[model samples]
Target: MVFDDKNADQAQSLREKMSGVRNGLKVITLASGKGGVGKSSITVNLAIALAQLGIRVLVMDADFGLANIDVMLGVQTKHNLTHFLRGERRLDEIVHIGYDGVRFISGGSGMMELLRMNEGQLSKVMHGLTKLDMPIDYILCDAGAGINDNLISMILASSETIIVTTTEPTAILDAYALIKTIVKRDNLHPLHVIMNRAESKKEADHVLDGFSEVLAKHLQKEVNRLGHITLDPEVPRSIKRQTPIMISAPNTSFARDIRSIARELLELPPQKEPGNVFSRLFSGLRK
Candidate 1:
């Protein structure tokens, strides 16, 4: 989208607002290099799990491929980044509240082409994030799977990233490639990994160990093993019901596993000034 003179000035104003938005604000981008690894699903449940522990969380659906989070929560997003950029809605006003008060923002839809936005469009959206007034401990971005400038930009802009992958060989390799790409692009980019749909904890541990070794050996990068989610039949059932497992079956092992990952994520310190983006929404404190 070409920004007119007035739009350019407004975007500049939003960028200026970003200067005050980084009071320990934590923005974590969740992604994968391959699809069908349940990245979006985990994004939804993990946000809810964190909220269950009283950590206010906002989940942004950056997965331009599809609004899986929306379908999972059975909620329709009437507004998105475009709306916020148009001056028709505040960034916070476009948020779609999901399970357990976990706020979400749709990444546009249909012709909106969320991922295809130009640099100026993306800059405006990123700057507008500071408009959010509600207190939030974490802003989890469920980035669309695979490699692209948009995906990489989102990850690099966030404080850190959590890459989700399954036990499949292709999935593991793709995850590694994605991580290596990030490190190659910016050696300091913090990254973590989550093994989804593992058959068993033993296997999960084995795979994580091997994967960690590969990363350390090849890329000289250290990525935390956030945790794993084992295969669960109920996960599909919950999806069919349009309710996340964290809400439909919080007592189940699947939900408990998500909570474990959330706890690990809580222990991570927020970047002092993540990419100099996301100014503090609160005066002196955030995150």
Candidate 2:
């Protein structure tokens, strides 16, 4: 197969941008204490929102056995991490372009071998990721729900983590559990809390206040509130239709909430000096 010269030029330009990535890449691991809390939905939408702000964004559907970013966007995957792990594909080969200019790497399901990869394989995987030719401003890792070695590694490797939860008691408790675990592992890692499916701002404020209070007293770590998403009927509809809410119903309240969250993240101060490059960060974690 022959490649287009113009495309190659553009690829070269992207690589140049990568080299000059001064502030580094912002890697955020979007995680939850449990499943079914709209974590994946938030991940996909937030990615699009960030991209819409003119920030080149990449989403790593790192949910492993339960990846859903591709399914949620209706993007068919010919090759995912499974093929890459087996040396059948490269990192760029497995990346899928999703709606609103968001690029993502899908995590194919039921690959027990992937979950149990040895050190050599792990090193290869990390090497592939750190060598991407495309330049990106943000990488949102939609990590699998709950705690595990992989999940812990991913979060610990990231510059920041967003803990998504709902107003439900179980969800809140589970969010706290995940936060406690992370704090126990690394207290200096910046943690952001996002309350999803909130019925009212009052409800969200109350829950977040109580949750933050408890976390401060127990973990002695202050959590940043990254805004909240309201319960919108159209969110599920958009998901069922394989479109992001930001696209299908851009005027909806849910879409606005996501955009707001994206803006808040963009307004955040960048890390000084070398920035947070995924390749550097993940490699250090492995060591």
lDDT of 2 at 52: 84
lDDT of candidate 1 over 229-270, digit per residue (tens)? 999888889989998998788767688778888888887442
What C-alpha lDDT do the candidate models reach, one value each? 0.78, 0.79
Instruction: Write one digit per residue (lDDT tens) for candidate 2, span 77-146.
Output: 9898889888889889998787878899988877777667553454455445556788777888888877
Distance from true location, Cα of 178 in model 1, Å: 0.8
Candidate 2: segments with Cα more than 4 A from true spot? 1-23, 117-123, 268-287
Candidate maximizing TM-score: 1
lDDT of 2: 0.79
The weakest ten consecutive residues by lDDT in model 1 span: 269-278
Candidate 1 segments whose C-alpha is farther than 4 A from its true place: 1-20, 85-87, 268-287
